[model samples]
Target: MRETLRVQLWPLPTLGVALAAVAGVGLPQLDARIQLDPPTWLKTYLFSGGPDAARSVLSAIAGSLVTVTALTFSLTVLTLQLASSQFSPRLLRTFTADRHVQATLALFLTTFTFALTVLRTVRTGKDEQTEFVPQISVTVALLLTLASLLALVLFLSHLARELRIETMMRSVHSATVHTIHRLLPQQQDTAGRDSAAGNASGATPEPPANALPLTVSASGFLTSMDEKALLRAAVEADAVVLIDRTPGDSLVAGTPVGVAWPRPGTHLSSEARARLVGRAAAAVSIGPERTDREDVAFGIRQLTDIATKALSPGINDPTTAVHALAHSSALLCELAGRDLGPRMLHDDQQRLRVVLRRPDLDELVTLAVAQPLRYGAGEPAVLARIAALLRELAWTAPPDRHPPIAGALARLRSTIDGQDLDDTEHVRLVELTRLAEEALAGRWPPGR
Candidate 1:
């Protein structure tokens, strides 16, 4: 729920409208109760108009704000369209999640609501009633209008900056980094090193002969999971739950997403198995779209999308592709120092209860490299960036983690070999490949 709200546009604006409604309705009543004598200078800032003039002023403000609000919405939609077409459809979330854009729309709508609400309170003497005007309310509406105007100017400038490819890539990078820190903890503790054998690092553990298949209830991308619930379910059933699907994996209804097996020497009953299946299914969340909340690969996929789009013949923007690769490289290097294996959850008894699959370094490296290699094979600049990426990852990776980088580096070499580059470009690429190899060998700066 939090992840869904974070990437949405309506929450902020809707809250603004509700607050504006309260202030609009409540402030006038307060003005009606309290009377004040103001100095000439103070009165100048306040609304000094008659009921007729106040009505005209409020009406103008409300009408103009409506138009401005419409314009802001139109511009936002247009930006979404351009981002979808020019970059990747996945990038639309980045623009929608922008707080600045959301706040600007909220400001516009708030002002409009306030103006209209205050406008209705302006009363020119009728039916022998005394003439009334909400001086403070009208004054606030004026100030809000001015603030809205300033916001309009700032929003236009912000939208322009956001349209740049560099800015977009940086936004994706920053958001992905936040997701990484939130989901993938650093393996600085010894306990973190105890990855299941044959699972991710060591030999794979086989399920019990009577292990039961666990199927998904819905068809969608596996977005997130409640680990505690899974653990509880496993403990109650006296079994180990192995989740075969990770965040960002597409799940199908009635398809086995994992397996549940009873602990060694334990007999399984049908009732417990049914309860475990229901609880486990409830603990996992599936959505139509992938979110960065728990899925590190989604970010890499977005970056790769940007790189491939830039490399397309229609765009032919090698520089942009290189920039995207740089971001991907940074993410991959960060992943290198962390554990990229199946996450094991244990009960209070120190027994493993749940095992969740995650993308390892090899899978992520390929995700970040494969498309660019295939699309930008002929571009020497793109090839060099990929080589630099591998070198950087190699620098931070442990010896065991070097194989994925080496595999990617080998592919880089093969791509370079296939490119019809001149002697100069070919040699530069070869030098980069050599540097990457040296880095993998625990050597840096060659002679140093």
Candidate 2:
């Protein structure tokens, strides 16, 4: 629920509108209650206009604000369209989740709503009633107008900065790094590596001959799983559940996403089987789009999309591709030091209850490297960046995890060999490959 709200543009603005509405209603009544004359200093800040003039002031403020609100909304929509078309559509989440943009829009709409609300209180002498104007409310509306103007300027500058590829890549990288830390923390020791990868606590469980398939009921991306709930269900059913789909994997309706079986010497009754299947299905959440909350690969996917898109013929921008890869390199290097294992949830007696599938280093390395290599094969700069990525990962990865880095470096070498490069470019790439090889061998060369 929180994640859904974060990526939306309406909630904050709606709250702002509600608060403004409340203030608009309550402030007018306060103005009516304060019958005493204000001090000279306080009077100076209050609205001094007569009822007719106050109406004109508020009408003008409300009218101008409506136009400004429309303009702001239009600019925001255009920015979203630009981001979606020029960059990956997945980046639309980043733009929509921007707090500055949301706050600016909220301020504008709130000011407009407040002006309109306060406008109705302005009254001229008529029907034997005295002249009345919400002096304090009108003053606040004026102040808010000034604030909205300043916010508009600041929002323009912020939006411009956000449009840059460097800023976008940095945001994606930061978010990805956060997901990595949350989902795959660094392992201080090699203890339990096998169990971390889904082996049972005592011994590897044989594949149950009567394993019941956990079919996916809806078609969408697997967004999250309630592991505790799944573990509890497995414990209650006296079964072992293996979820083969990771958070970012796409699911088709009615397809088996995993398998569950009763532990050895146990049998599931018909009711228990049905209950287990229902609980297993309910534990997994699917959404129309992927989120990075539990999926580290989503960030890598975004970065790869940017690099590959930049390398496309329509936008032949290799420098941008290199910059994107630099960010990707940081994420991959971080992942190398951490334990990328399938999550295993256990019962009180230390028996594995649930095995959740996750991508290991090799799969993530391929995710971060493959598409860019295929698209940027002819571009020597991109190939060099790929080589550098391997070098960096090689330095961070443990010996057991070096094979993926070496495999990627080998592929980079193959790509560089296929490229039509001048002598200097060829030498640079060859040198990078050699440095990566040295790094893999626990040798550190001097300055890059």
Candidate 3:
């Protein structure tokens, strides 16, 4: 036979009921009409008595302590879980989100409710006749309330500090992406184009622009268990893993792991790309060995697949239209040889930061222009006719729409007919093409 053990958590309403009964009946009845001025020790023993007292004052204290401890632990666990949940991401996305305020108010209300029950129970007299009603001093009530509130604030403040450290980790990830993108060739293209144009118009060139250097930092408790394996994986990926320079040798945030480095040159060999993809696949396979690094490695693998597919053919296999749009956006950045998507993986803030650096519309249009010319050059007239349909499917929209790719094709036609390329026009075209790709491919972006 198996034995089962159960633990009962005290209910809050029970505390309230016990307090009311003690104040309204028990304490009052005991104190009523006694009229004897007891010594300090005697009074203390009667009110704040040992376990053997008639009302068992020590038992009440023990129960209250257990209840309060359980409540506090529950609340702390709930607050931390809430902070880390998917809801937290949505909440953070909202303009008015404030975890600190929410947590503090929750803690305060919970503590205050317990304090109120305790005060009510304490103020009831221990005499039989007075048990009908207990006298509570205003000063005592206020003091209890104030003490509970103070304790709540202190507890919540400590929780807030933990939350701050998490927030900083996210910030560091965002900063790393921002810095890396600043150093890439695609990032300098706009300025380079403008400078060349200015030179053609016989103007002096601007000063040499300072390139943003990629700085890797990381922080958190890293234990001894899998450090060597993690370091080996990083080295295999050609990414650098940086640790803090301080005494304890902690991992720093924004520290680029060896696996996250860009491809060595302007173009990767087919064999090299295959190897990189294989490495990413291997990482994904091995990640489940450790729970702590599983999510992080999974995210990295997803990003790697996106980057690989964007640069090379035969990699786009998203499951949904929205996912395709996100993948295409990331892929477009990769094709333009930009680092925006990788940044998004590193930091949540990169979602917005990526939009700032407009994608190269011309490159996307060039891809659109080439699809038909490469695949459908010499067939029967009707078969050739469907080539346009196929091209539209590949470049403009998914195959299931009413007019299939008509709307997107029309938009591209307008761009082709001679609209001056501005940042807005480029971004719009990129978005449209990405949506089209997504509709066909069924892929959504990270954090969508």
Candidate 4:
């Protein structure tokens, strides 16, 4: 029920439906008044065609709207199915959020409903009563019908272009980049902090075994946490909270979502403990499926799906797999230069209150490349393409984040079988390997 409400309130659908209903309800009142002194241009047979003509026009529009609305829905559903089967099913969410398609559907429905409502007002010479013509309503319906036709054409054109592989890849790339920006802002380098903390190089000892574990209330993906709320809860309880799960992690009921511990030599009262646990659980939200809201891993999952589909035995398209790799490498490059896997959060009073777990750049790189790399091992062209992408990422990434690329290169080397490659293929493979080696060591060191 909650998910259904969320879907209904999604901005694209909500706005479209709300606007259509508003037009249906309000436009008739405007017609009732405006038809009394309709323009000189509308005084002709075209606009002043009495009750008979007005009913005919309204009926024509209402009937045509039904047909056009069905056509719009049919085309949208068919295209989405094709795109999902050919590219990635995750992209269905993108289509649902699209404003253009939603607006087209909204306009058609509004025209149909508006025409039908005004038709009810067309009292067609019953008992020889005074004939009435809703000139304004008929004129508006005609205009709406014309606008809907234009929108239909635009929708068709947009759908045709959107189904292309390149277009889908670009859309996924843009969304993942946006998610990165929101979830992983660049961090200041830690040189000064490192210098000061040199003596504290070793890992901190674990908390007391009796520390309070904030149990997860449900099983789902950890979509997001309210940082400020968690901080306040910690401050009020005079404790520190360490998050066990981050935005992309899966959760199960009864598992520890996080830990809350008082400062050394301090303890939480029973009442405080209960309140703190409740607040901690309230600070986090879980959902059945991962959301793009802040989960970078979900974005990686979409790219992985595209690559997996392309490499399947039935499809056997290494070129598409290569495209996915190129974009994945680019995304990894952008992340490599940014601050990742940091654990501290501070309150307004400048006290540390919360510690979060984050997936580091290396983990993200592996997640994005692993599945495709595994499936493409047999295709020499696929390996060559993967090598080029690895080279690009290593070259473009900051010098500090290269070990993952080196590791990937090692993995690629292990996957190659000499029996499968011809002399020509071996020569090309050697060149690609040299390129990967240079990318890792030329700026960034191996096995860091």
Candidate 3 clash figure, as a count:
39
Tens-digit per-residue lDDT, 296-382, candidate 2: 899999998999889989989999889988888999888888766666777777777888877889998999899999999988888
Compose the digit string of candidate 4's lDDT tens values, residues 287-370. 876667777767677877888899999898888888887788788778776656545665556556677777776788788778
Residue range with the least summed lDDT across 10 consecutive positions in model 2: 195-204
Off by over 4 Å in 1: 36-44, 190-204, 446-448
Q: Which ranges in model 3 have alpha carbons more than 4 Å from their true place?
A: 1-97, 128-230, 234-448
- TM-score for each candidate, following the candidate numbering: 0.94, 0.95, 0.23, 0.88
Candidate RMSDs in order: 2.8, 2.4, 19.1, 4.4
| lDDT of model 2, residue 253 | 86
Instruction: Give the per-residue Cα lDDT of candidate 2 at 274.
Output: 91
Instruction: Summarize candidate 3's per-residue lDDT along 366-408 as a digit string, tens digits.
Output: 3432332222222122122222332434443223332424443
* Consecutive 10-residue window with the lowest summed lDDT within model 1: 195-204
Q: How many collisions between residues are there in candidate 4?
A: 0
lDDT of each: 0.87, 0.87, 0.33, 0.76
**Cα lDDT, model 3, residue 229:** 37
lDDT of 4: 0.76
Q: What C-alpha lDDT does candidate 3 achieve relative to the native structure? A: 0.33
Which residues of candidate 2, in runs, are more than 4 Å off? 36-41, 189-206
Q: List clashing residue pairs in candidate 4.
A: none
